[model samples]
Target: MKPTLVTQTALFIFSLLLYCAACPAQTAQPAPNQTAQKVYVGAYVMNLYEINPDAHSFYADFYLWFRWKGDIDPTGIEIVNRIEDWGANDEPFSDSVTVLKDGYNYNGLRMEGRFFHPFEMERFPLDRHVLDIQIENADYPLDSLVYLPDTANLIRMKPTLRLPGWDIEGCSLTAKTHMYATDFGNTDLGQEPYSNIVLEIPIARPVTYFLLKLMLPLIIVLLSSIGALVIFPSRSYVDARISLPIGGLLTAVFLQQSYSDALPDVGYMVLMDKVYLLAYAVIGAVVMEIILSANYLKRNKDTNLHALRRIEWYMALFLILGFLAGNLLLVFL
Candidate 1:
């Protein structure tokens, strides 16, 4: 009986050894509870990336990184934009994708991730847009940690918003964000330059010139109005000097209000500001002219109707005609 028992034990042990050799012991997997992925976003400057007139063709390129902790590889993140026009098939212009690393596979782990040329900008010129990126865990698992950008080990990316002449309006950014899966913990919330585009504008001047916009037009109008005072002196001769600029001052006040709505409230000079300063000086000249004329013509000298009238007519005639001639040169030359 002992001999028989020993033989059976030996057979069982041999079978066990074979099983171990054939199928190694499996490492455990976490519970089926899925977690939403986390990702970091950044933008860099290069004089590259242009969109054609039709907006359908784009020559845009930028590197996006997907970073995470607890044994995560690049396969964890995906740049999820629809390839409708390109149609997912490999056509000549059908949206190309390339990676920095070729012939190197991460074997299910790569924190250094990049997605290039995933899709074109947009088909419409005037339409606003964005690209949505989704991230997930492909290998290993990471829980929360206590540090900057926490647990992501992202080191960082370069040159935050407003690329080259791309000053954002209001600096308010005009972007909206919605977060999901935070309940399970993705500490990397919405961040700067998370969304980026070259803005594709042929001219990137300031949308609203706070300093010089109204000032330019104001100078033009004020100059013209001063010439008008020189022209209309016979009609209202009592306050010839102060009349034009005072009226201009009121008009300028209204113009300034209009400018306030268009530009931010700030103290700085621009082309517009310089032009308006010229206008102010012109208006002040009109005021000074009136004061000097009043003193010379006399506070109590019987209103020299004929002599004053003659002076007004010729001065206005010469001044107005000269201004018009000069304006033509200014406009053309």
Candidate 2:
């Protein structure tokens, strides 16, 4: 009972199909990428109590948390931007982990510590700053663990959170790979990138503070200096006019020093410093005008007193307008 040619051909075709199906099962597939573990990180800021521009730091109370699956534990996190203070930080859940109903592991801790941020004071009272709480896993490199911001609810701040001199603008969260230049003491591993999560809080001073507290006093001092020009250009008024500008000069210096003490000593001048410089210049100019007028009165006996009075008026108007315009340009532009 030998098979026919057509039957033999059909048998060979079936055998080839079977072999093709079995080849895929026997051959090995490429391995999946299992180098990094994905971690979702978030923060709920309860309060921001102290912000010191001179110290370049701010005190914050917040809850930091992490969520992830599998066996990787990313709870051992460190605040990279935190200022070290012995026995100051309060972390109650520093050693606990919870397994959620969906099998994802969770861990959180309350942090009360000072965080460092180099504040940009070019604008001073008008300055806006982003205070950040940067976190990183000290034990895990970026290759082993990567942070993902919980975009659904990344940043949550308390409804009534407030800072004394600042207004809370908004908040945000971001994840990044922070690469270190040195590998600490590990010469074999070289430098490795670390997963970093930052919770940022944007804050700015209220415009009312700038207007009422800072600029209003400065304007008063400037006007007082200009008032010296309005006095009579006579011999009796010489002492009064000359002394008025001098007094204003002293007050302006005192005002500037008072604010400067609140800020760090930086090489460059801030906006408020520039404004004070203008004030000083205006006061000096007033003194010069008064001196010239007095010399004319002594030598010529109020010969061109009318012209001198007119010049003084013009000078006063010019200084006032110039100061206002300069301030506007410095602030808005």
Candidate 3:
């Protein structure tokens, strides 16, 4: 039978709707970034026992925890720490893995490992350094895996935690993408990328330790050298004056040697070195002053003895002030 025009129009519209629905409804393009895995990191530092600035390394005993949400088993995944000074002792003391029905993976361990700490020793004893414990995925590139700081689960020591000469200043956690080049022996690759999480602990050394151990004794010796100028004016007295400064000079040499044994082999001079140089100059000046003063006394200048005493006072004051000024410049500037 022949259909009317309106009925034919309705049938045409219905057919088109059915064909479109059958083909497929357009869905939002599956996000390209949905497959990326993010690993969360947390740590509790148990102890930091040894710190060797000369070696530029530190030892830390810590507990680490990792978590991620993924369908695949995380058991095969490896955790890498970039700050490892040596390859030995990288494994954790006790490691455990857990997988939940909801597709979450948890990994935790307690480990004591030696990590590398790059120290800034410009100020040496007065310097503050940030010690970093860095971790990342060894096998996965940044495209596949990333690390995040798990601030919720972070455990840290109090600021009171300190070594004999160091005080814990602060602590922080951060995560970022780290990129570097890999050498194939023949040529360098474009770039290799990894996700890094860093736990930073800042430590400071007290200035009083330096003052007492190094500066104080040197100051005492310098003061003792002044005694040379105050002694009786006799021909034999020149020997006493000479011996005083020479003894102080030797003591300074000994102290410097002992101190240097603990320091790194850096090329630049440090604050302590400057102080020692100043001390040596002062001692040497005193020796020279004593010689000149004794020669004047040998000329039977009893009247000029008072003038020599006044000169002695002037020399001591000048040396002391110069030492103080030099220290200020070295420390503050």
Candidate 4:
């Protein structure tokens, strides 16, 4: 009985050892969804390849640069940082706003994260530049979406928008209205393209000043000055007074038209407006001189004779003084 008991005890010990050996290794259980990953997000200036001028819209590719900061390999996951959500607050917008479940399709330079960067225009005049990033927020695990055989979850990465190394070829960003976003990743996963950050490219200062302060306003002023010189200033009876102002106004009109296709339709004045206003003023002066001359001729029988005589000096002095005073006030003030 003792021998049998010893043998049974030995057998039980052996069975326990075998069971332990067959048990799974206590190496390490991967944490639930592992720890969240961190990464840098930004945008880059691009050379526009195509453009659509009518909509004030164009197409340009945004190069995004980023670096991963996590314990696990940052693969098969995507990062979407800049999200334009019309559904927010139930605000309605166009029916064409494009949203990507795993890809992006739309116009304009869109991206997420801070570091305001602007592209050099003249390099790509027609393409809309977009730099927003889209990341796949998948967890790291065997049973997670990443481990699914034959499936790919590209790491969601915000586009890398770096500051210019040496004057980004042909672009510059205005510091005030330049677009940028803060935070590296979307903390919210429930929202599609989830990101609490809203990035906005403010109206470019140079572009705004150029179009409004220089171009469009000038066109308007030039148009208003039309038909002035032809009626105001004429040296000959054969349509000379009417012709120069007409020609000048026409020339200004043509110049204004040349750039009409490139500008957006907005209401504002520009440097061009100042120029046209000046041109109109000159045309008005021309008309006044013509009328004065005609009246002078009728009063004095020989207008040319009066012009060349003592009256000429007085008229010259008055005009010189008037112009000097006007220009001086404008310049000094």
Candidate 5:
């Protein structure tokens, strides 16, 4: 009975050993959750110049700084909206990291470069735009690091900063996580969001440019075309009436082209274009009126010159008032 019991115990121990070897103990463990580090960013715009709508770019010079805690380096930054210009940009203001009295690491630099912005030209001379400067840490993902706007003095511009033909309305600063669509071929990392800081300057064209430079010339062309109706309805004055409107039409086309040249090609017409279209229609109506009147006089041997003059005056008044009213609606509403 004792020998049989020993044999059974040996078999049980052997089975237990086989089970342990087949299962194997797990050595890999899941990583613990880590809190993302925060980096404070600030900027002071010194100058904004060379704003060119045709090129869809503008030049800016600004001072940029960063404040962060711990050993993580957040100074490896990239200007997301900057256009690459070989050797034209300024170097960093600091050669090494700055240790502040409050136990934070700081670094700063003066940046000068051209930035890209897709200008909305629907309003053209009356358009308003917000020029922005976007900064991102090229090395750190939002999971590991995030940005905080130095709200105390987030965005400051030079007191004397001026952009010709543009009025600076105000400025704003913000920080947010910007996500890229692709994983950048890193399946392990997946699609990571990056912390970004944006400094925006709202600007608008001066009202004088719209009123005097653009609208005034258009008004002149319109008045000149309307003047064609003032000429007397006689065989001798028919050439004058026809030629005046034709000249005004040519001038209007040239004026539209001049402003259109300053803007990029867009799919739809702008407010100015709409105004010019009204002018064209009015001029065309004048041409037709002159032709019809000339035809009527030829068909009837005795057409009253005084009665025809009265009709022409009424037509001119109607067209002028209609044009003015249409312009007001287009501009205001």
Candidate 6:
């Protein structure tokens, strides 16, 4: 027989109570474990490779070494060169991987790639530059990965290797944390920071190269053009004197353009540009000296000829000394 209304209501209440008792109470989720893995980073540059000042990029060949805990296979961890736009990955460049006596995993990566870097060309051929190699794990956040600089085996450029225009002075490594922001869809990830290891190789340019190739020619042309002022002012050689300084000015302009093409576009004038400006000034002075001396001679002023010649000597000396001083200041200061 069917139960009465009161009985049916009582049965329904009992079932509800049983369901509540069987189910566990809800609690907040535990926070994610933010434990970090220790990784040792080392690098050795085997080749200086190529440097493109116009493009503001460089190519380097180096052996990148890493030692990490064996508990996790860091092979999947992304290795990024922090200072450059180039990417490096595990591509079987190693002959074999080694397991350290301390139970750590070690691997060496043979990396040869082009990296974009902002080259400072204010000094140009006389400049010393620091080429940096930065590495980090892409997948692991800073809280999950910490890079330790391998000081004992720090990054070094081969000593025996000599670059044509550069000399390697020193090498060093530094450890730091890099902070990065994520996209909107990855807000749960929030702003992630990564472990970064940086290797710096300081290279210096021998001023001798610039002295020989650039400064020597400039000096020669300037001296020749200024020498025109010493020639006795005569109608026969008037055109020659004027043409000499003009030709020197044109030569200086050509040299400046050629050198500028090798440098990156910068807001301010470089030391080389300053030197070119000095050349233009000296040439202008020489041209004026020629015209003035010629005009004085044309007027047939024999009494003032010696005075004019003496004045030319002083002006020429000033121009030469001024050019030298300006170049020295730009190079040393």
* Candidate RMSDs in order: 24.1, 16.3, 17.8, 25.3, 16.6, 18.3
In order, the Cα lDDT scores of the candidates are 0.39, 0.85, 0.73, 0.38, 0.86, 0.75
**Residue lDDT tens for model 4, 155-248:** 2222342232111223321111111233336555322212111112212233444446444654454434333322322244425644554665
- Rank by TM-score, descending? 5, 2, 6, 3, 4, 1
Pairwise TM-score winner, candidates 2 and 4: 2
Top candidate when judged by lDDT against the true structure = 5
In candidate 3, what residue range of length 10 has the lowest lDDT sum? Answer: 72-81
TM-score of each: 0.33, 0.82, 0.74, 0.38, 0.82, 0.78
TM-score, structure 5 vs. true: 0.82
Residue-wise C-alpha lDDT for candidate 1, range 155-272, written one tens digit per residue:
2222343333233221111111212333345346321112111111122234344225533566566665566445433334645546666888778767756644544344545334
The C-alpha stretches of model 3 lying farther than 4 A from their native spots are 1-36, 71-105, 118-122, 158-162, 183-189, 230-236, 297-303
Task: Give the per-residue lDDT digits (tens) of candidate 3, residues 1-333.
Answer: 356888999899999999988996674322213467877777777678688897788877766677788653232433344355454344543355676575667876666667777676768667888888777665666667766777776456634456767887766778766666553363554455666778788888887878898889888988887667667545676887789989999988998888888888888877788888888988989888887877767777454666667778877888888888988988889
Task: Tell how far residue 182 is off in model 2, in angstroms.
Answer: 1.0
In angstroms, how far off is 253's CA in candidate 1? 1.7
TM-score of 2: 0.82
lDDT of 6: 0.75
In angstroms, give how far residue 132 of model 2 lies from its true place.
Answer: 1.6
Write one digit per residue (lDDT tens) for candidate 5, span 1-333: 999999999999999999999996884322212587888888888999999887899999988888899678887888898996663476676899989999989998888999999888877677899999888987988777877888878447888899988999877778866778889999998877788889899999998998899889888887888888898888678888899889999999999999888888788898889989999999999999999998998898798998998999899999999999998898888
Q: Give the better candidate number (1 or 4) by TM-score.
A: 4
Superposed by TM-score, candidate 6 places the C-alpha of residue 212 at a distance from the truth, in angstroms, of: 0.3
